[model samples]
Target: MRKSRAVMGNLLPFIIAIIFIFPIIWMLFVSLKPQGLGISNPLKWFLPPYTFTNYVHIIADFQVLRWLLNSLFVGIVTTIITLIVTSLAAFAISKINFQYKKFIFIFFLIGLMVPGEATLIPLYQIAQSMHILDSYIGLIVPGIASPLGVIVLKSFFDSVPKEVIESARMDGCSLFRIYYSIVLPLAKPALASIAIFTFIGSWNNFLWPYMITFSDHLYTLPVGIPVFNSNYSQDYILPMTVNAVSSIPLIIAFFFFEKQIVKGISFSGIKG
Candidate 1:
């Protein structure tokens, strides 16, 4: 019974993974189908008449490359800024003792409960007032306020030995030095997790960029792809092609950072 249970435990995760990944696999196959062929029949999707025609047409006709570069830029910038801000905030919350520290930590926790959609109107007004609309500043700046990263990193930081920090202080290490040298090195897994999550979120973001950006040049992949699709609404292959293209970066990111993701989430859970 124990052996059977163990086998079931191992098997369950694979089953779940397949369930999640199956759609992406289907989308890839559908994207490869000739322009008019895949939409009518689902079963014919995997059949042998595949070509790169859709990819070629989309790349040549649309601003997809520019959109791709825009998404990459925003995602990378957002991830970097979020890591720096959240790590510093997390370090302060975890290591430094001050009045109302618990209150400040709880304030950040409350931010996690607030839905991002709720802030869109205010954010839009603020961006409009600041004249940052239709710019990279609008796309990248708002996303850096990451409560989730602070929460995750704080949990991991809590797991670090207080004695080590004290020793560093005793040895005349400044707070910034301890944070830069000791805390960050120990929090690599947590930071990696936050970085991946931030990048993916920024890359996949459609609504904010769509609302803020007026120009095609400023549009990110999620927003830009749909504009491309609107013109070719009847064609299934083209939509799938853009989706596949948009997904490729994220897929590559996950493939390379899978270990870091798992390790980070595991550490967060255990430490939290």
Candidate 2:
């Protein structure tokens, strides 16, 4: 019984992984099928008269590279800004003593309960008032206010030994110096986890960018791919091809940062 349970535990991850990865695999397979063909039959999906025609057409016709660059720009900028803002905020909440600090942290915690979709209208109005519409500033700015990053980083920051912070203070280190030199280094795993989530979220973000930007040139990959699909609505394979292309960056990011992601989750689970 014990051996069976242990084997099942070991096998569980592989089973879960396959369940998650299967859709992406199916998407890629369908995208590889000849352009006009639909996957109405599951058996015909693998028996592909496979071609790169859809990829070639998408690249030639659409602003795919431009859309990719736009997404990369937005994702990178959003991640950097979120990391900076959330880390500072988290450090202050976790380490600094201030009036109503608990209230402030609780406020951020409340932000987690508020669904992002609920804020779209107000966020749009704010962006409009700022006149950042149809621009990268609009794309990148609104996403920086991440409550999740704050919560994760604060949990990690709280785990940092108070003794080290006091020792730094006794050494005449300022709060900024302590944060920059000591706390930030200790919170690398949490930071990595936050960064990955922020970048991926920004990359996959569609609604805000779609609603804000009117120009085709300003469209991110997620937004752009859908627009392309709208024009070629009858053709199924092209949309899949574009989706497959768009997914490449995220897949590469996950694989490269797989260890950091695991470490971050483990550390957060243990510390938090």
Candidate 3:
């Protein structure tokens, strides 16, 4: 019975993975279908004289490459800024004993519960007031100080031993030196996890970019692909093709960073 239970446990994840992955697999097949072949009929779905024209056309004519670059820029910038800010804030909250530390940490936690939609109007107004609308700054700045990133880093930072920090201080290391040298090196797994999560979040973000950017040049992949899809909806295969192409970066990111993500999340649960 124990052996059987182990086998069942191993099989369960594979089953769940297939269940989740089937839709993406189906979408890829559908995207490969020849133009003018509708997917309305189940039997006809795979009865395809497949072609690469959908992908070819999107790359050749649409702004997919540009949108992809925009997303990459935003994702990279947001991740960098988030890491810097959150690392500092997290170091302060986790390491430094200061007045109102608990209050400040609680304040950041409150930000996690507030929905983005609730702040949309205020954010929009602030963007307009700052005259940064339709610019990359508009897309990048607001996302830098994310509460989730702060919380994650703070948790990881808190797990660092107080003795090690004090030892470094006794050895005449500055706070920034300790943070830069000791704490950050120990927190590599968590940092990698946060970088991947932040980049993915920024890359996949549609709503904020949609609201902030007024020009086509500023549109990220999630925003641009949908508009392109709607414009070319008559060619049913095109939308699916765009979606498949857009998902490639995320797949590549996960393939490379999956180990770090798992390690980080696992290690984060350990008490200091």
Candidate 4:
């Protein structure tokens, strides 16, 4: 009975992984099916009629590369800006004593309960008034002040040993030095987790980008893929292919930094 339970425990992760990954694998297989190949039986996808035509046609016909680049740029820029601003704010709130600090933190926590859609119209108006609409600045600026990012980093910062911070202070280390050198280095796992989540959010964000960007040139994959699908409504394979292409970057990112994600979540939960 003990041996059976141990074996089941070890097998559980593999089972869960297969369950999660099965849909992505199925999507890829469906996308690879040759054009004109009807899905009379889903199992037929395993046969010899697979072709690269859908991928080739989408790449050659659609501006997938441009959309991909736009998403990549927006995602990376948003992640970087979010990390920098939130980390500094978190460090100050977590470590440095200030009047009304608790109130400020409570305000940020309130923001977490507010749905993002509730502020879209106001944010859109502000962007329009600032003349940043249809620009990269418009795409990148709105997501920078992430309350969740601040809260996560603050929790991680709070978990850092107070002794280490005091020792640095005694050595005449400036707050900036302590933040850049000490806190940041210690919070790598949390930072990595936040980066992954922020980047993915920005990349997958469709409604805001769609509302803000009128020009086709500025459309990210999340916006562009749907447009492409609508344009080629008759071609079922093309949409799937485009979707598969759009997902590659996210998959690659998770594959490389999955460990950091797990570690960061674990560590952040320690104090929060």
Candidate 5:
């Protein structure tokens, strides 16, 4: 009975994973199908007779390429900006004993609990008032410091040994030197984790970009996919192909960084 139960437990997860993965599998299959195959009976969509036309169609579509570049720029910029700002802020909160420390930490922690949707209207108004509506700055400035990133790095920095800082200071090292040479180097795993989170969030962001980005030029992956899908509803396979192609970079990044990502999260919760 015990052996049977253990086998069942393992098999059960495999079955669940298959169920969850089926849609993406179906999408890839459909993507390989030609335009003629798109309008075929729903049941027949999975059969062979695949073509490369979907990918071809996207390549021929120049606007999609431009949109890809725009998103790439935004996502990369967002990741860099957030990583630097959050790392510095986390370093400060952990190292400096300033007035209102508890209150400030709590204030930022509250940002984590506040849903983005709830804050959208006010953010839009502020962006408009600041004359940054429909600009990349509009998207990036608001997203510079994530509450979770700060919290993650704060704990990681706290785990950093004070003796190291003292030793460096005894050698006449400045705060910046200590952060750059000692602390940030040791916290590489945590920083990588933060970079991945920020990149994925910015890459897949739809709602805020959709609201702020007035031109067709500004659509990111999530938003761009739907627009192209609607425009080419007769060829739904194209959008599926685009999505598959778009996810490739992220999937590859995760494959390589999975260990670092997990370790970062783990260390954030640990003392050393």
Candidate 6:
């Protein structure tokens, strides 16, 4: 009976996953269908004749390309910055003994607990004051130091054996040397997880970027989707196709780091 319950629990989630994926699958199908295909029953997407008109047209659309490039740049920059800031902070907090270290860690963790909306107005005002509105720095700077990244990496570091760090220190390794060479390599799984999270957050960020970046050229994927849709006259198929393409990198990252991703998340919850 216990085995049966475990099997049911496992199988139930798969059923739910398929149900969730149905809409995405349908959207991909509709993107393939030409404008003439009847959408009265949208689920009957496979019945229509397939064409690359939508994909080809979207490819020709310059704004989508521009938005993609902007998002790619911002996301890459944000991810790199977030990883460095968070990792160094996490490493210091985990491995070092400084006065008020706990206070500082708690301060950074405040970012994780609080919703971004609470800080949006102030962040906007600051951006305006600094004349960074519509600039990449305006979008990227605010998010470079993630509280969750610090918390996640800190947990991973806590799991590392202390002896290794001691040995490295005895070998005349500086604190930064030990952190970069010894600690980070063991926490590669956590780093992979952090990079994925940072990339996804930056790629999908619309509200903050929208609030700050007024220029059409600076829009990221989420904000860009709406702009593209407006031009398409609510012809969602083309925009959704472009969205699917943009999601490919995120999806590929998940696929490649599936194991590390799972381990990094689940085990991080288990403290030393």
Largest TM-score belongs to which candidate?
Answer: 5
Q: Provide C-alpha RMSD values for all models, in order.
A: 4.0, 4.0, 4.0, 3.6, 3.1, 3.7
lDDT of 1 by residue, 81-170 (tens): 999999999999999998999899888878767788999999899999999999999999988885878888888899999999999999
Please give, for residues 1-272, the per-residue lDDT of candidate 2 as tens digits.
Answer: 99999999999998999999899998888888886665677889878588888788777865887898899999998999999999999999999999999889888878767789999999899889999999999999889986877888888899999999999899999999999999999888778887887787789988999999999999999889877888877767778888998997778888899987676567446533
- Could you give the candidate ranking by lDDT, starting with the highest? 1, 4, 2, 3, 5, 6
Against the true structure, what is each candidate's TM-score? 0.83, 0.81, 0.83, 0.85, 0.88, 0.85
Q: Write the per-residue lDDT of candidate 6 for residues 1-272, one digit (tens) a residue.
A: 99999999999999999999877777678778786444777557777588889878777878777888888899899989888888998999999989999889778867666777888888788889999999989988998855777888898899989998998899899999999888999988788877876777788887888888688877877888877777775556776788776776777887887886676567446522
lDDT for 75 in candidate 6 is: 88
The Cα local distance difference test for each model comes to 0.87, 0.86, 0.85, 0.87, 0.82, 0.81
Candidate 5 error regions (>4 Å)? 1-10, 38-47, 260-272
The clash count for each model shown is: 0, 0, 0, 0, 0, 0
**lDDT tens readout by residue for model 5, 119-171:** 89998999999999888898778878567888888888999888888888899
Q: RMSD of model 4, in Å?
A: 3.6
| Candidate 5 lowest-lDDT run of ten | 263-272
Alpha carbon lDDT at 95, candidate 5: 86
Write candidate 3's Cα lDDT for 1-272 as tens digits.
99999999999999999999888887788788877774567757666577888778778865887898899999999999888999899999999989999999899878767777899999899899999999999999998856777777788888889999999999999999999999999988788888887788898998999988879988999999878877885766778888988897788777888887666456445421
Error of 6 at 40 (Å): 3.7
Candidate 4 backbone clash number? 0
